[model samples]
Target: MHKNLSRWREGEQAGRRYAFTAPSPTRYPWQWYWDSCFIAIVRSRWDRERARRELESLLAVAEDGFIGHIAFWGRPLDLERAVRYNVVRRRDLTTRTIQPPLLAYAWRIAVGDPAAEPGIAAHHRWLGGHRDLDGDGLLWLLQPDESGLDASPKFDHVWGPRAQGRRRFPLLIRRNRALGFDLRRVADAGGPVVCEVLTNVAWSLSRQACGEPSTTPALVARLWDERTGRFVDEARGAVHRPLPPERVPFTWDTLAPLALPDLPEEIGRRLVEETLLSERFWPGVPLPSVALDDPAHTSRDHYWGLRRYWRGPSWANAAWLAWQGVRRLGYRAEADDMARRLGETVVREGLREYYEARTGAGMGARDFGWTALALEMLSPRAGSGSGSA
Candidate 1:
């Protein structure tokens, strides 16, 4: 246990120590949501006190429970200034719109650690309720970026008015299609407007909070089209009138199956297999993102340049979701393998805000939530041995 504790300690300290970075060539950094989740998970194993501290540190700095996406050496970052760089916040402009909800998930895992219980409960209570943007009982994505398919053309119509005209990169039309990103509307040549990912994940959390069978299944099933291999927006339908077959499926599209609790075994297998074949889904790399594969898949530099925010890239957050689906289907080895690769990539790449889909390289802000989650997964203490799924 001590050796495991040591490993946990090392992992937690690594996050705490590396948590801050220079905002740019000169500014300092602070703990982000992704980093906190990683730090909290690791801390829960060896030192519950540290886990609570991690959340406390965040709360002390947080304004109204909505933590900022980035900070400079413990000071909140001024993201508005970074808009020129295409760094987006949730609609609120306070935090990065789309972080993996691993914090809630992690808290659930660590609740047994008495020191962690209060903090975990507090955070959960903060996130437990619903925000009915569409008035559909399902939560709405506060920001398009929260969907992790940022600036993808699919939102040109869906979210254009609300996002204030943030559209997909012009170059993504060809590359996204080529990479197999076509199946998902988020990669539409036009840009996706509405975000379903955040809303769905929120529903999942809501179910967890209420301690009831998931209602997401009914919502997901409503979106599923027998005609198409992917799910469609219940409100807008497909972005393209005669939607391209390849454009309909994205990594989030695959999540529909996992969210649904009791589908026929064959039906579940088919969705997974389809996702595997979708070139845009795997992108020739182990990492999974909103886009599967497209010719103009985001390159690390392209993303940093805001040329292809969500057109294509292996996002750690999406990888976490994909891993969940893989595990649900008894693909434990594959899931763990992915967790290791993603975690190693974050450390090796010295990650920035995001990454390039064409190549598994980091881009955007350094040590952003996606990459940070990857690091936490690599922690020896962060497995089923420590808690439940």
Candidate 2:
């Protein structure tokens, strides 16, 4: 894993010494927000200084608490890719969207880097102020990609198949930069907003890492579907207490809230037995991005550059996040089991971007960076993070 991670590392690109690892050398040459966070978590295990510098390089482009998703370091921004992603080399060349706010957790776990605190706090404030269109405890995602479960069927109801809104990824940066990324009028005009599950779970955990308290109204009241026993995306309107059978799409994010420490005892345990450790997601591999019984579920890596990247593959980052929550909730046996299988999968698959959830077949980009998190899952402190933070 370390060898693969080192092979994918990028540094001194485009006349800069900023160092960070690309998710894949061939497929994903650019730096990604959340991918860097996950990689840094494992990179700390090998060399803490390198991990710190990696995050520092990733955050170099952050301004006014707003961080874009991708940074084209060695590559130059061109007319075609620029128009497609809405970025220009001369004018802050990165998309305007944010990924999961995991920097705080990564920094905390990597040993309290104070440099990340202000930006982390400001990023949370940006989300709280700009998102949450309804001010519910749950936050709204202006675009599907912001949740990082890109192209998952869980969002088909919002943007149809393949998350059509992704085409607008670049526009957010232009508008925010024009408006100074200020508190008011942050969201682009006429974009759809849904209170997504994964973003809120990350929000819940990262906010705690910053030592910030959660907002009012409570996520349980807005996002938790008691009837379905999973977290569902809420697109405006109060979720009735009892959701009808199969009322919401079940995807990997269904188990994401398990990472939240504040989750109730009954809720967390049920999430463990009925969902995380259940046969539905644990078909053969430890966890699949989408539940096995979901109508859109599939374990094949049919699409790569096109879309639908997260439908049913087993992602190392997803497993690490679930393992964090599962172990925190006192299900060490199940968490350890997942860690063992995940480490073996990494060994068998050789650090690909994602693997087949059911058969453990390698898929997506090879020498993928975050698959290194399988090692973190096997660490002694793997279960150290709390549902509280």
Candidate 3:
């Protein structure tokens, strides 16, 4: 279904060999952390060897235990764009921040090469050591982009108003750059830091996959809001002088914990019956980054002028994540329906960066890579979740 994925493939060799899928050839040439994980998962369907190499390429760029959100492989980079976007150090050509630690999850589901386990463990360790600011078992995000739901309304409070956040975004970039992307400096200087729900959900899954002790799932359970019946994001600050990450918006991010197999009975039930089945999330598109009823939810990604994304669009990766979670929770019928809707949507509209929340129409970048994740949903399964709608 995602045949264009092959067209988005690229490689790097200043001296070493590296190959990975680009989110988009023209728009996003750099390899991203979670994007590669999603790409690797789907890549395994058609080509197992390439999937392995794609992850290997991603790991080759990890510096110490930390893996940057974006890996600017190949020394020849657009220095201006690199600096403007995110580059902790020009020499490393990787961001100082991290994405959801989905490497182990991807490896197990896609390749499971025993050799890659060490790198996976180190990446997980790096996160636990550096990103977990207050021993809350949840990792804190230094920048909004680190959440992979950049520009999501959940973070609008960080930079004042959502619209003003655009102008102030560069200021945040400059501030992080000034500190050389040091965790201690960034956390202490924190105007706003977050313990994002989606990120911790991914971390808990990956950490458990790597056999690391998981205090995150328990902490994530604590984020549940009795009033909303949704788990909210935390806002923990610097390790030097730490404070718990406060509650933020209760967006679709609240549903991420459902992916866990051991999700609490009541929490998972409310998420499915109240949120997923309701009009707010399932109006037309199976799900949106933000809930449909949310005031911040808009049809268009106005926040991003040209590359607008993640505000309210229905992303394939997000759907895939949700599908995996719901299915694991024994909601087989509902999970299959989600896969059917997303698979059908992608078929009707071409693979794009994001889709319209209500119509499932394509939006953002063209020939997107991770949207290829739909292949898994469309694949043959042994049970009721087997076929697409």
- Each candidate structure's TM-score, on Cα atoms with residue i matched to residue i, is 0.62, 0.86, 0.89
> Residue-wise lDDT of candidate 1 within 1-389, one digit each (tens)?
11212212111221343222222223224455555654565456556766655555544434333444443333333654444222333223234333434445545544343223444344434333423334444443433444445564444444433332233332332333343332233323334334364446544543453353554555555555566566554334333343443454344445444433344455556666666435556444445445544433444334334344555556665565455556567766766776776666665676555555556676665534334445444553444322133
Worst 10 residues of 1 by lDDT: 1-10
- Report, for every candidate in turn, its global Cα lDDT versus the true structure: 0.45, 0.70, 0.72
Q: On lDDT, who's better, 1 or 3? A: 3
Among these predictions, the greatest lDDT belongs to 3
Candidate 1 deviant stretches above 4 angstroms = 1-31, 42-47, 56-102, 111-130, 133-136, 161-195, 209-213, 232-253, 256-267, 290-292, 300-308, 336-355, 365-389
The alpha-carbon root-mean-square deviation between model 1 and the true structure, to one decimal in Å, is 9.1
Which candidate ranks first by TM-score, i.e. highest? Answer: 3
Clashing residue pairs in all predictions, respectively, total 39, 3, 5
Clashing pairs in 3: 195-234, 235-245, 235-246, 236-245, 259-325
